[model samples]
Target: MSDASRSGVTPRRPPPMAPMGKARYRVMMTLVALGLALLAGRIVDLHVFDRSFLQGQGDARTLRTDTIPAHRGMITDRHGEPLAISTPVVTLWANPQDLPEDDIQRLMLANALGQELDALNERIARYAEREFMYLQRRMTPEAAQQVLDLRIPGVHAREEYKRYYPAGEVTAQLLGVTNIDDQGQEGLELAYQPYLAGVPGKRRVLKDRRGRLVRDLAMLQEAQPGGDLTLALDQRLQYMAYRELKAAVTENDADGGIVVMLDARSGEVLAMANQPSYNPNNRAGLDPQGLRNRAIVDVYEPGSVMKPLAMAAMLETGDLPLDTVVDTSPGWMVIDRFTIKDIRNYGKLTLAGILEKSSNIGMSKLALRLDDPVVPAKYRALGLGQSPGTGFPGESTGSIPAPVRWSSSQWAALSYGYGLSVSALQLASAYTAIANEGRRLPPSLLKLGQSPAGEQVIDPDVARRILGMMDQVVEPGTGARRALVPGYRVAGKTGTVRKTDAGGYQEKAYRGLFVGIAPVSNPRIVTVVMIDHPRGDSYYGGAVAAPVFSRVAGNALRLLDVPPDARDPES
Candidate 1:
């Protein structure tokens, strides 16, 4: 039409001659064709090459919460024997915000359970206002399923675990118990909580109206179960020790008794037992008194049994010799009006003789020998009064007062094992240095990465000599007559002390103590026995605690398959 219009309509513009509506239709068709091609490709992927992942995503919505309840690892003994294990049980938990009270209206009473419905209701109800709470723990699987069937609003059955102790009270003090939370609470359980409790994982997915996962989760973390725990306790030995202590406590009418057995060479605690123990399953019945696990927790005047440690300290320091004699007669010695007395007197006794006779005055003399700042330095070296550095939770370190401020009376009293308090575990562990040829390896409840290539606490020769002296203490000396274990040469000492009270030292209260090593050629165990407040007659260590020692030692040696020693019962 016009020259300018013609140039504007050059070949590049295509002149817009075709129907505009038709061109729009062509573009629409092209877009529709591309979309169809994409759809076909997706369909091919869904039905063929990668159908599982996509189909799984769709299935996740209905079955999203599929879970696997992994078994908690078992706690085994050093021998790979089961000490504690997880037994599956159903725990009842509820979303308190949605639960109806009618679901748990009453707790059914089962004689074995020991709890009433009313009590159950109260315990759970206390936490009911909270969003989440445990309604019950460790219920039977069948009972759990029944509760689940009720399908009460917010009421759900959670599968959990209950700790089962195969040896029951025999290993209770060491294995410990867990709370309702399926968590470890005390003893070894507390010690290994982190490693023994596993990492819990989670997954999230869309669910259908029926609560089944219909689509695969965008988030799925596979749960890793807990690692198994191995303990240092020997179940059989523990049971034997427990039985021995229980029998002795009942027979002696003692207020309480403690028995500790140590692996003489390794310093590993083989067994530790106390009387008046409660079944862990019924922990609610445990009294503060009953709950007092005395082996590690209790500290008392160790009496004459402490002489060996004191004597070992002096000998190891090369400051005192076994033949060094001290005058210990008159059955008493007065230092500044505070008299230190022997339960029985020996006129003149060597350091070894003092321990053999269990002479308090004799041990007092030895403590006096070491009373020089340089002497009891060996006492400090032996780890007395310090915590055993043992890994056991709640263990008491015991007390050894600094002799730096030693009053004559305190120093004298400390000599014969009064004023200075020691735990059975500490004493046992310290003796390990002697039995281990003078090395004090840190005691442990778990296996060590490296054995306590330990610190030197004594001269090897001195330790050997001490062992021999201990043997004689059980052979023909004061600690002898009662601590006779057939077939083994046992070496140890006896101690009898007036139990102190809040008012003052109890005039009549006594603690009978005995500590010994067996198979003297190569000591196997360091066993210590302590009996408190023995009633009626025969309260001496030789009379009360020694018999306990004899029974425990005899059984322990035999159980260990220790070869018989050269000892004549008649002799």
Candidate 2:
């Protein structure tokens, strides 16, 4: 400052400062250029050469491939009524490592999830070593949404399906149930699993830091919807049968019951129901017995119901005629030291009279005339002693002693319906031969477009003659009179079978059964009702099972619009 004040021109003169030294300037410029080059190289490497690695690292945190759930198939009755369906549900899951460390956030999450705080803490601790854990499964979307809205770290929502049964216990045993993962576990559901469970899908999506889906990027696979299944069940008829059968079982105070109604022409199962059924939709504390489809799985002695087929066999041998008569003065006979008795004696009875009175002695005489194998052969020919071919799981092939060897007592018992076991379904199917003019159609659970060509198991004339004789069993007002319908001709047989134990037959336990065809002039439906261990005053098939048949048959015929055909319209 003093120098400038002293000399006025001093500022201009003091110096044109020398330019920066060349080497130092060059070194500084070079250093700056080198730094910029390194930066440029790094940018190029990140955008091109190392692009995948950098992008992959970023994507590891934000992008994810997720599973898209598939909806299971719908099961409908023959008339397009819903029976079983799949409803949308949500499942909550978590990544333990990504969970919030704060206790407050965890508490909020536990409350929203409807879990006890202690339990949630225990669960989280148990799975701390695991990256993935299921928090809750198969929750309603509304319920799961509440938990998801908390935005708790590591929590996620997955779309899933839960099976819903529309018919509830009405169709439980038949439709069966799926597992927690929606895989079929029993019944027709198990039979048709591959056809019902559709293929799942995959998709790529972007998520935020908190694991919330930001946007869908691309579909890796398209989900395939399951195929729809239409069964041969008539829901209306099924309800009717179920109601009538349940009422009978309750009124009789029976242990259990089964009713199988079949279309005689098409062989489609119209309605099959069992007592003590469980709701498939909710199966907590379910008794395993409630899951049995008793119609197709349980076998018992056919009792007196086997008489028609036996008589048919006798006629087929040309050894007896419909007008043939037998003497029953004593009311009982001894075959191999075993007594075969009738309810009472009618002295001499014609073949038609024998059936009308359900004469055990008369059938015994006819059986004595035939070869030992004749009656058993007739049963086997009529679809007994075999699976009914209904595509059901655990279908039983009922047992019959091989005709190769036997006893006179056994043969005589067989003629009157004993010494052999048949399922309710097999019995119903056997009656189809008598109802369908000796043609035995394979039983079906699925609907068919037309009636199948059937196997002829007996002479059409023999079947017709047998049907003619059974007409008297109902019309006489002596046997099975309770089975009479208001405006239809009914004909069938009743059976009261003594249950067998490890030792022998039980005197107190009896199964009452009835198999019948209605409007005997045309014979459209074959219905079988079986009540196991009826404890009421009467356990006779004519008393217990026939009334159930009358109710179910009357209602079913009207529902199908089959016109009434009784000679006296109001009886």
Candidate 1 local lDDT, residue 344: 65
lDDT computed for candidate 2 = 0.89
lDDT of 1 by residue, 481-502 (tens): 7897877788787888888879
lDDT of each: 0.74, 0.89
Give per-residue CA lDDT, model 2, range 441-524, as digits (tens).
Answer: 888999899999989998999999998888878864666888888889988888888999999998799999888988798988
lDDT of 1: 0.74
The window of 10 residues in a row where model 1 has the poorest summed lDDT is: 104-113
RMSD of model 2, in Å? 6.6
Highest-scoring model, lDDT: 2
